[model samples]
Target: MKPAAFEYHAPATAGEAVELLAEWGDEAKAIAGGQSLMPMMLLRLTVFDHLVDLRRLHELRGIRQREQAVWIGAGTTHSAVGRSDLIRQSAPLLARATPLIGHAQIRNRGTLGGSIAHADAAAEYPAVALTLDAEFELLSPRGTRTVAAADFFTGMWATALEPDELLTGITVPEWHGRRGFAIEEFARRSGDFAMAGATVAVGLDADSRIDRCAIGLFGLGPGPERAHHIEREVLGSHVREVSAEEVGRAATARLTSVPADLHGSANYRKRLGAVLVARAWQRAVEEATDD
Candidate 1:
């Protein structure tokens, strides 16, 4: 199907994009890469009176290491994230997960900000961001504001971004200690949205005890869900001492609230969540231990 006719405006800078959004109000939709929005628009699932193109916003593109964080511009593509040596060194978990997003072609055209802004429950980035505790920078005509990943995603296909706000960049803290990270996702095919997935980041103390850990899972709730209970349980326990089955059980129990969908039953999804978390946790432990 063809999309409805709309006025198109290409902005050279983020401020210009903000001004365009402010002028068009809710009628305007900012597009970068157009991986998600274009399909929805073509199907008439979503319509916009004005299309604000952000391809020229060079300010919103790059990867850099600041004092204690890695800053990734919103315009950076998934392929870039997957291939970046800086990201591989500073944010290994993200690097590991980026390649798993669709395939090479999708990765080439899909933007990091687009995926996060889309906030699809089945997306890999949202769960990864939540695990990394990444920060999102949102720009608007009024001003700029930063939101933690936990607060940025409000619900399925929903976020805290105002209609006039454009996500400018993402900030991920550097992991300094002995760390291991892993992403485990189950999809019918290589490029399909995951049925259930887990992104785990684990850091070990000198004694090999789990000092810090994050478990972010998706495909089980309105949006990506954090496995807080599992984290609490794993902390202080040695990876060798922790029972993945027990952790899996605990994970399954906490997901009672996730609704059933056509792809999976609520119970089935809960089981998959448990399995993913256990596998991701085990692998992360191994990686961190080897480091």
Candidate 2:
């Protein structure tokens, strides 16, 4: 099977890309890396008549740090972000979760903005972005708009992006060595999509006690979502003394019911999700405490 015939345009700037989108209207689709879209197109799941390529757009291709956050250009590859020492030091959660996204080949070509825009529930970016409260920069023919990660995802395989909108970048808050972050999942293969997974980034205080925590799990909902009760319970507790079982229990209390597919049954996923949450939090706490 082949993708439908389409005009391909490699735009030099985001504006030019927007213009092409405007011209093509509903027939146009913005492509970056094409790690995800290419497969969908070949399967005939996607049928765009015009392909707007953003690879030539130089503006969306760098990582910058500010007092408040790190601004990752839309074009930055997952492998680039994963290997950057700065990202590891500043936002280790992203670094830790990147390798879990897919294999090296996919990570080398897949872009952060593309992953976020693609909004795959089993993907890592959505979980990390949601955990960190990252902001998305969307550019359109009219102007630009910023969307918070939580609000950006509406449902399965869906996002807040409009037909004419192009995601230009993502802004992640700066790390203050608050807490250590950790990730865990139960998958059959090294690079396989998680049947169930969890990511925890916690910040500790001078007293070596938990200050705050963000917990998210994949394969438990429409997308990776916060384990709200677990976060609330973990706050103020010393990381070392916390039990993985307790953390898992808290997560199960909130996200016990989720959709089930070929991965596992809803019951099995719910129980396993709690376990992953506990382990991820405990590992994150230990990491933070060790430093």
- For candidate 1, the C-alpha RMSD (Å) to the true structure equals 1.2
Which lDDT values do the candidates have, in the order given?
0.90, 0.86
RMSD each, Å: 1.2, 1.7
lDDT of 1 at 259: 64
The candidate that achieves the highest TM-score relative to the unseen native structure: 1
Candidate 2 local Cα displacement, residue 174, angstroms? 1.9
Clashing pairs in 2: 178-203, 178-204, 179-202, 179-203
Winning model by lDDT = 1
| Tens digit per residue, CA lDDT, model 1, 159-224 | 999989999999999887889999999998999988889888999999999899898988888898
Off by over 4 Å in 2: none
Estimate, for each residue in 1-291, the C-alpha lDDT of model 2 and write its tens digit.
Answer: 888888899888899999888888889999999999999999999799999999998899888886778889999999999988878877788988898878899999999999999888788888889989899999999999999998999888799988888999999996686567888888878887788888888888898878888888876788768877777877888767678788887877776448787767888888888888888877877787785
Q: In candidate 1, which residue ranges exceed 4 Å CA deviation?
A: 257-259
Query: Which clashing pairs does model 1 show?
Result: none
- TM-score: model 2 vs. ground truth: 0.94
